[model samples]
Target: MEYCSLIQLKTTMMNNFLTLFIAAFVFISCAKEKDPIIGNPGLAAQGEWSIPLNRILDGGPGKDGIPALDEPIFVSPQEATYLDDDELVIGHSSAQESKAYSHLVMNWHEIANDWFGQEPVAVIYCPLTGTATGWHRKLNNQVTTFGVSGLLYNANVIPYDRNTDSNWSQLTLECVNGELIGTRPEMVNLLETSWSTWKTFFPDTEVLSTETGFDRSYGVYPYGSYRTSEGLIFQVKDSDDRLHPKERVHSIISGDYVKAYRFSNFPETAAGIILDNVEGQNVVVIGSQTQNFIVSFFEKQINDEVLTFSLPSDDLYTNGNFTSSVILTDQFGNNWNAFGYAVTGPNEGDQLTPTMGIMGYWFPWTSFYTTVDIYGEQ
Candidate 1:
């Protein structure tokens, strides 16, 4: 009896120790920033998300509509020019003539500065580890330097400098993950200098294919030290300010975190979904014609049961297309939902007529449920 008691006591102590260790790991590492609104990549039934036929966000150094800047990075087109628009200039990097999509420099820069605004982010996307990282790159006429800001996901920021390089003679990075990879000027020559050229930088990275509806695993940020893969690692407007999936140049426009979509004019086949107990849900609330859809959650799936609700079309949209305010909540009690309308179908004499349609602008057709915190995760 004495020996059995001793064994039991040891087992109990061991179990307690393990429980404490696990608790500490979760407490120390599983820290999530308190974000109210989460982006859900609403996946459709066909296992495809709807990708706009046209690319909404424009890139490159020089372009119309956008104002010019002091940066030297420019498109390699016959008439290379300075970039004016912030969005178009977001990804512009002075890489080797071969590697137009060289992100190694950009990732180093972005990783240094957690925030990416109008300035350029030197990017490096490694598909093997699914790591998409960047750096804030700056170059003068003769010299160049790379800054490293260790701001990672779900952790306190770490500021560190890796190296200082002045002679950036040939801008290209070498990638070898159990194999070999490098971008040569010849590869750039073969590409038509389109976005595909940029994608070549991440041969193994996953990007949202124009042909596919599925969004690349763009927002997946892991804890500790891990590499990023090639995904939608490019710069984009803040979630609130992002353009509709279909609006090409307009979607990439940078500025205020504007509310661009509503739910009033949701298609007849569309269904409204409500998530209960959403702790950290950043979902892109999409109303589509079929039940097929995908929404990414901080957790593989939301813990709470989802409820479906319907608001009359008449109350939602003046025409036939509309977006509802996104709702994020911690519990079912406080639901934050808003709405935006799309100018797709014919709504004769509607104020949001095609003639008045601005690609990325949102006009209020129906009042949002402001009573709830749209940014709060339920």
Candidate 2:
């Protein structure tokens, strides 16, 4: 290399320094763009965070990375052969229609934006937490869609609404962060049971089809062994050992009170019915071991008559179909189905108001409601 004058050398050194500085600046900018935290600025600013923001890990998928089903397709139950007989499903019904969303499909996409009758709804399922529930998607009569926020609270999914960008805790059933903090979405009753049981209940129901616009192996479980494993993937601050951490339970929340009933607590052979006082409200829980189904409804009084229920005996007339009907007899010998509808008896055509409840794993229920009361306990 030729030697240069002092002034010329100084100028050359300055140029090299500027080049290095520009390269460093570009490198830092690109690095931040790749950061999950920096990529989600709206989520970063979410207020009233229940857990430490740093604890919310990138669940391998970014926001909307696991796409939500917006315009879901459906087919008759006969066409849903991909689902195993014992595989779980979320079932919902309105006055006009009944639908089933198989766990096989929900295992990949946790949220499905659909409608029940004329009312918009979001069917949400968290495989990690073993929770499946439905929420009214309309806020102040305006429709909103939800997506996976790539965040977890107590190992449960946190869904964010596309309209307000508000992050909601699936277990808590309320907006925990962003613009709609503390807002609770109206809940619709959803039944979680085996595919076989659901089909038995609603043979003519429509099933969510795998034609979800996204390319995902709907037959394969995305979380792998996590579903069967007892250990949690993320940290949860609270727990209760009354039931197995992964044991499934049917939970009901009313006002500030919550209660959970495990499958083990139900009678093994026949149908069992229990009336419990929850938050001063009389709630009736009905379970069928043979059917593998449990549901709760508020005790209703018609014409100042309080209805108490019991499992219908074998002799009761069940529309000539005892195997398929979940018949319950009141003190007056009126027959009712699991849905609290008086099908045949003196009270025929009457309806028992259904209470909004959920079926989920024990750990997540306890993690969200630490003080939840367990049925049959003091």
Candidate 3:
């Protein structure tokens, strides 16, 4: 299945979403007659926006135009034949469970609202910017599902909570407008990597099913040539030409500082580890081009002790090489998985402290943090 051209995508979106936006405008018209303010107008929508209003582009589809998935379906790794090995996925995992949201389904519907055990989570992806994050589905203890506001800031998705109609900037990691202004959504750390690498490491993982209720081409990318092209469909607030705009990078954000860690900086021929620091936080980054993965975790352990990590030795574990995503062996002999969870050792049940990290295209991260730092850059 080939990607829908810009014309075809817009036509399809219009066909599916026209009625939803029609109703929105109707409500706005009625609300405007009674008072100057309206509810979710799809035009500056609501509240005094934290971002410069001029920067918010009118992403063609109006509110709920590009539908978000609710109560998404999932299948076992073997059942996910629609995915290819090299294709990437955003993973949200824990000791109890692990799930992979493939880019194939995400390209059509950018958000998937689902439950991971008892807690609600919204897997938010911005296809244009190639950024994905898992947001806890709650605000001040009240549960809510997020929807596509049909808006773009820095060419990234602006998700609004159904409970309060507040708009959130995915890359900015905060609410920029509406009732929940200035509030930041609680986030779950998500690891991004290729399907081959993920399924190899986590054979028992649940993959997001292509059986989404919406009728979309599951394997085809909706946006044409956007992934490889240097052009952005919408403008960003800031940009830097140090790296190709679409080159994917793992970013660790702390307070006001953001560090971009590239796969090129690590040894690609074989799995490698980089013990580094980001904004005073010691970190261990592991990756390999052969494995098609790169990930990071805070070096501070659950016991509050900082430990040095290295590639597993042949003599230590079972046989020749330590395969799977058990990419690190700490001095204490704990083997840590890509998700930062300890799989073996005295602290076996404990999880490594996760940093505020996300993987996305280089431009989006740089645009968000104008002063973004590139590791190994001279």
| Candidate 1, superposed: residue stretches over 4 Å from native | 1-13, 21-121, 124-136, 139-144, 151-253, 258-378
Expressed as tens digits, the lDDT of each residue in 97-182 for candidate 1 is 12232222222222212212444434333221122323344323212222322211111111222232111101122111111122
Q: What is the C-alpha RMSD of each candidate to the true structure, in Å?
A: 21.7, 10.8, 9.3
lDDT of 3 by residue, 216-262 (tens): 88878888899999877666667789999999888889876789888
Q: Model 1 residue 54 lDDT? A: 21
Per-model TM values vs. the true structure: 0.23, 0.82, 0.85
**Among these predicted structures, which one has the highest lDDT?**
3
Off by over 4 Å in 3: 1-45, 301-305, 315-322
Highest TM-score: give the candidate number.
3
* Residue-wise C-alpha lDDT for candidate 2, range 1-378, written one tens digit per residue: 355687789999999999999997786666445532222334465566654565465565878987889999999877887888888889886446779999889888999999999889999998888888899999866899999988777778889999988888887788888878888999878888788878776677899999988888887887778766766666566667777777777888876567988666676766667788888888998876566777899988866889877777766434332344445788876787656677778878787887767888888765566468889886
